[model samples]
Structure formats: structure tokens, C-alpha cells
Target: MELVPFKDTGKAPAQNFTGDVYVTSIKTPTEPSRLTAALVRFTPGARTNWHSHALGQTLHVTEGVGYVGTRDGKVIRMRAGDTVWTPPGEEHWHGGTATTFMCHIAMLEASAEGDPTTWLEPVTDETYQSAGN
Candidate 1:
């Protein structure tokens, strides 16, 4: 029964993303828990680099349109209230579309020992355009 101190929204690190982005961490469970949550916002045409969670990740869209793409060439267009899940080790990237700001609550679980998130190369114009965005 303790309160977690809220922190100010911060700019997302370029090391983990491709363009301008920001995030505000909402919750990170203590030692006994393994969950982490954040409110992530992507500027128009901004997105994350291809990466995957060790356990998995879930995103609940809160506003604007979102574009999610996988290596399989599928791009999912999601809107407010839409939920998207990426299974463990699935390579994918997500962000705001060409003309809108997007926000989502992202949830992730800590991975077991010896298994961590794997980040891949940046998404290229070829791949991004392939998404039809």
C-alpha cells in the first residue's frame, strides 16, 4: 500500500528509437513484481527502431493513429482504444503515422536470467514505405 512517485515526462533516448519520441514512466513494480509500464508518445513520423521484448510487450493506444509493422510486411493501423501485442522475440516497430501524434500505454515484463531484449537495426525507408505509410 505505497504510492509510487510520479516523474515528469522525458524525451525518449535516441539509442532506442529512430526519431523524436517521449515517454513518461507510470509504474515499475518493486522487487516482488516484474511489470513495467509507461505512457509513450511519438511525434508524427517518429517511431522506435526494430526491437523485441524478452518476455513480451503490450500496447494500449490512447490517442491518434498508430502504425505497427513486422518483418512479415504487415502494418497494422490502430486507433484509440486499440490494443496490440507483440510476442516474445518478435521483431517489430511501432509509432505515429505520417501526420498525427500518437500515444499508448506500453507494458513489459522482465525477462528471466540469460534472456534479454534484442534490438535490431534501424528501419529503412524501404521497410517503412513497405508498410504503405
Candidate 2:
């Protein structure tokens, strides 16, 4: 096994995220590997847009508090050591709560065709505010 070098953290794109968020690459698919992972951090009130994965996704909370939500209005409060999984093709969003900064390790596998995620519209302020309700 080879050790991977650390990479710099970067801000999450405004096009796909609301408020302040950062991401640092952990691993990316290479050759026979189809897995991808990253360390994602979010400031209070920051969140991802509605999105789905071709092969599903998993997130493990590492610090602070956050919420994971779905189109069906299901919201899960996640704290450090908590993990959540979203099945393939299910639209969802995740991020920090209004009063807490959050950090999680995001993991997923690319589809056979190499596609992993499809991002959709941003989660509305009303929707974000209603998380966990």
C-alpha cells in the first residue's frame, strides 16, 4: 500500500453550496478503484444543494452538529461519530445547523460509467430553516 499525500483545502463552489463550506480531497478513483472521498467542513447555515448519487453516498460526522435531509422531508440530526447513508438516486442535502459548524467525511463510489453525483437545485432557505422539524 502507498501513502497518499495531503492536499490543500478549498472553498466549496458557490454554484453548488450555500454559505461557507470547504473541501479537502482524501482519495479519488485511480485505475481499478472507483471510490472517492473527502473531508468537508461547513460554517453555520451552510449546506449542499439537492443532489443524488448514481451509486449512493455515505457521510460520517467528525465534528460539531449538522443535518441530513431528503426531498420527502426527512431530516436527521447528526453529531460527531454519527454516520448517514443515502441510497442510490435519492435526492438529498446535508450541512451545518444554524448555530453550529460541522465537519464530515463524505464517501461514495463512481458508477460503472464513471459518473457519481448529479447536483440539482439549491435547498431553499425555508427548507434549511425547517430541518429537524
Error of 1 at 6 (Å): 1.1
Candidate 1 structure, TM-score to reference:
0.92
Displacement of residue 34 (Cα, Å) in model 2 is 0.5
Instruction: Give every collision pair in model 1.
Output: none
lDDT, residue 21, candidate 1? 95
Per-candidate TM-score against the hidden true structure: 0.92, 0.97
Q: Which residue ranges in model 1 land beyond 4 Å of their true spot?
A: 114-116
> In candidate 1, where is summed lDDT lowest over 10 consecutive residues?
110-119
lDDT of 2 at 123: 98
The lDDT per prediction is 0.86, 0.96
- Tell me the tens digit of each residue's lDDT in model 1 across 1-133: 8888889999998987877899999987667778889999999878889999998899999999978998888899989999999999899999988788899999988765633467778888677666654
- What's the CA RMSD for each of the models? 1.6, 0.8
lDDT against true structure, model 2? 0.96
